[model samples]
Target: MKLKTPLLLLLVALTSCGNKPDLVQDNFSFASTQLKQAFVEMDAVRSAEPREKQALRDKQNLGPLASPRNVEADGTLHMVISRDWTSGFFPGELWYMYEYTKDDFWKQKAREQTALIEREKMNGGTHDMGFKVYCSFGNGYRLTGDAAYKDVLLQAAYTLTTRYKENVGAIRSWDHSRDKWDCPVIIDNMMNLELLFWAFKTSGDSLFYNVAVNHARTTMKNHYRKDYSSYHVVDYDTITGAVLHKHTHQGYAHESAWSRGQAWGLYGYTLCYRETGLPEFLEQAKQIENFIFSHPNLPKDLIPYWDFNAPGIPAEPRDASAATVTASALYELSMYDPANGKDYVMKANTILENLSKGYRTAPGKDRGFLLLHSTGSKMHNVEVDVPIVYADYYYLEALLRKQKLEKEGTAIL
Candidate 1:
């Protein structure tokens, strides 16, 4: 890919200011090598003794578990089945590799990984249809234009719509947290709306578009604080469409802003704006950016503590995953706001630079996961300060967005 002249000059100036030159290219190179090892490790695990493997495979709904989720505390690679929300992220990373390198090898790898998750299209019991299906099949279709992938996407979108409660105007997020929330809707659900929008476009079904729009509007009304920070979960009265509770499942407290939740809002609304050209979504995304960047507690390195209100402050674990998601969102948000485009790119570049310099795994470490120090849920003490799959997925996505901006003067939608 060749950089357009003006963006090339702008990127050069931005890199000279602080970032390492060719940061995007260098990261992708690092990712390619790391991901190759990830594949080997995953393959080895899947080739375990037949009886033991079959029992494990049965737990994953009869499919081989190949997607890396995280490394366990004891230095073991943790792979998840398609039913896991995170299963799609590694495949998405593989797609990103193919997208950046245009290498047939990565394409084949992505296809193989993505195939493992195709069964998720019919999984309606969980609200993570988008996370499970779109991240894998959606990217696959986008790159390959495979008709089969399109069918999977359509089915997944339909399955996701099943979770949308007409009274609540939002998709139910978790079915298991029933004792706490009658009809729970989460900020994370915003990320899934993109799959619905794509389904509308592909199938010409206005229902998908309307459901996504209504969900975005509803979440905007109910989930946000005065400062634009969001609550992690909002429980609704299924009968009356009234909010029953607003609290956090993953943040420090009920009122705290979960860092990854904020990043999800940023990325979600930006894509909503891209898909709908709605000024409200664009304005919402900008407000979220302001809240994040202007917060005093955000680190100098641009990574965030697990929660903005976490009591530990500098002692808190940093979530590199949040930074990567925000970086990727800002690159696209920059395109939508020409007045602030350069500033957004500069900020995003700084984040990428910082993450690359400090937050990445040491070379040949961590079973090929790229970025490190991501907290899955500090409140639950899960995956604290560990390398998680989604962090690497968004890190590569950010790099790809930066590359597209420099080369074509536009970020991919």
Candidate 2:
């Protein structure tokens, strides 16, 4: 059945009144059972280790916002211990865990880890303040209603805006030397626009909303190919906003589709539609959704190779990070497109099942990071086939979203 309205009624519509109600409910019930088991396994990992406690106390002596990134060969938790794009994911994971398990242990850890990066609210040198701050404090405030978290989020939103180049109509993504990139705007920047939207909604400041819409419009004009597969980076002339180049720093080639960039574009546009109720953004999202599901190289499990055009085919690395991000995006998108809501929800559930059963770490392993086999930069030969922090963050997020739908028949707000 094609959905015409997406809401809490979707689960009921599928299982209670559909053609094969029993079969549908049975499969959905089993999927929910498996996810509940995953929740237990994750909590066990957290309870078995004091790693986060130690990291919190030790990070002060190491560096700023020292988020745990991955595990070392010796089974020690490798720390970011510096400014990087992924620093907020760990804390965001903690917040979700706290919300899921309702354990004070995770709540305290979430608070501690979130506090470490409080300074990113003022650091505008890079364009990743959203990833570093919003995912941390944004979830924190959403769940806890702490006034302090609100203040930090607003500050980070403002700091993120400082990177906006009026001429380019987008935020500068990288801070490489002036000669190297006149004004670089990456597809990943789409993920950061959520903070700006939140800023405007919460603060009643249209400045934040205007910049975000402008950036989205500019990216929609330039970043996409005819197929809705996106370029990784679009460099603009700093003075006149003219196109300088469209390049791929992370994918297989300049013309290939990078899996994670595509996920970001899908999620970003879905989010833009939710925030603005704009038909164009929803159409943009559905276009990317169809591209991802119809892509020739997508695996049976729905995970994509690091690059859709990568030469290695089945031998190329499967990106759990991209899959997790897409799972979360699809779950949210399902709530908006009723005609395809059942398909979207079922696909999201399938992705969660694959990750929970196939890509998840053995408990008490992976330095307590949950998922495995995420590729960071396969072209650069960095962090290939290893567990990554952002992968875990989105995995937990998908879990939570799925759980919400299972129980309350609503998407996570």
Candidate 3:
């Protein structure tokens, strides 16, 4: 399927057909089965000796957010937490749980987490707030018609809009002094633009779409390398629309390919194509996929390291979080172009299988986190192989995708 704009928009609408008994009912069965197993494992890990004894606070009082301790691969609970508030993402995961299982626990947690993130006022600093909030509460509203979620999403959208710099032709990633490059763009921000698109529909506003197109076009021009691999960051001279320089802020170095960031590009552009039917967006998505899947660094199980070109991964282990995100993105992409559907589906499946098998600690090991070996920020030597909230969210989403497929047998567009 070519997945033109009208067809993709139709699919997006159908995604919210929660009342469809055949789809939700069948997937709910699979979700319930896996969730039951996960729950038992979580409980056993919670009651384990190591976690009970060396709680996050007891170890070194790493930080407030890290207080909810969980075991790492080294069989120790890491404490030194940085960043107290992670917005949109934390609550977003909770909302996914609520949607998947209709569990009140997930809904309650979403409300609590949203309030906590809002209290910290973490909205305007970066583009991540859209993914963090909309993926959770925005989804909540879309699926359930909850007006409250709309209020939350709109507020977050306003915060995102205020960050827009007309002079730069892009939204600023950070407000740091060291790097004051105007209109700097990151591939990860593409995921955030979905919320902007949604805001346009809700408010009948053109500004949101204009911002999204500018961001998308800027990324298309600057971030992509010859092989389709992308730079982690690109600074643009907002005035002349000239490329200032390309740098890898989060990856190993300027030339290194970060697997997770590439995944973001693939998933983000696929989403852009879905909304706009831009042939360029679809082509870019395919280009990124070619680079990612063809890389020799891909593990046999299809999970990726934190960086594709990282040195001696066994010595300094890679992040399984990258794999989880890629899996979910591939699953989403499969619907658009079924020619490579099985390849992407199988890749996602392999990652999920490996994660549920090896990466996950056994029962009575790590209660709160579903997957281990997630690297948060390798540059800072922090959370080298600990649980990350985003990894957990994506892992659950991949599982949902698998369940959705096995049950629904591919809803033909």
Order the candidate numbers by lDDT, best to worst.
Answer: 1, 2, 3
Of candidates 3 and 2, the better by lDDT: 2
Candidate 2 has its poorest 10 consecutive residues by lDDT at: 23-32
Candidate 1 Cα outliers beyond 4 Å, as residue runs: 1-21, 48-53, 56-62
Candidate 2: segments with Cα more than 4 A from true spot: 1-65, 72-76
* lDDT agreement of model 2 with the native: 0.82
TM-scores of all models?
0.93, 0.85, 0.78
The lDDT for every candidate, in the order shown, is 0.91, 0.82, 0.69
How do the residues 299-333 of candidate 2 rate in per-residue lDDT, one tens digit apiece?
Answer: 99998889999999989998999998999999889
Q: 1-413 in candidate 3: lDDT tens per residue?
A: 58899989888879867455453244344434433444454445445646644575457633233223334556554331223323445456666677777789767766665554442223466667666567666766766677866877777777787777676677767556445566677778888888888888788788888888788887877888899999988886767767787878777888999777888888788778877888888888878888988999877777777888888764656678788878877777787777998888888877887877677644444544566787766776766777765676777777777777776864211
Judge candidate 1 against the unseen true structure and give its global Cα lDDT, from 0 to 1: 0.91
Best by TM-score: 1
Number of backbone collisions per candidate: 0, 2, 5
State the TM-score for model 1.
Answer: 0.93
Q: What's the C-alpha lDDT at position 393 in model 3?
A: 70
Superior candidate under TM-score, 1 versus 2: 1
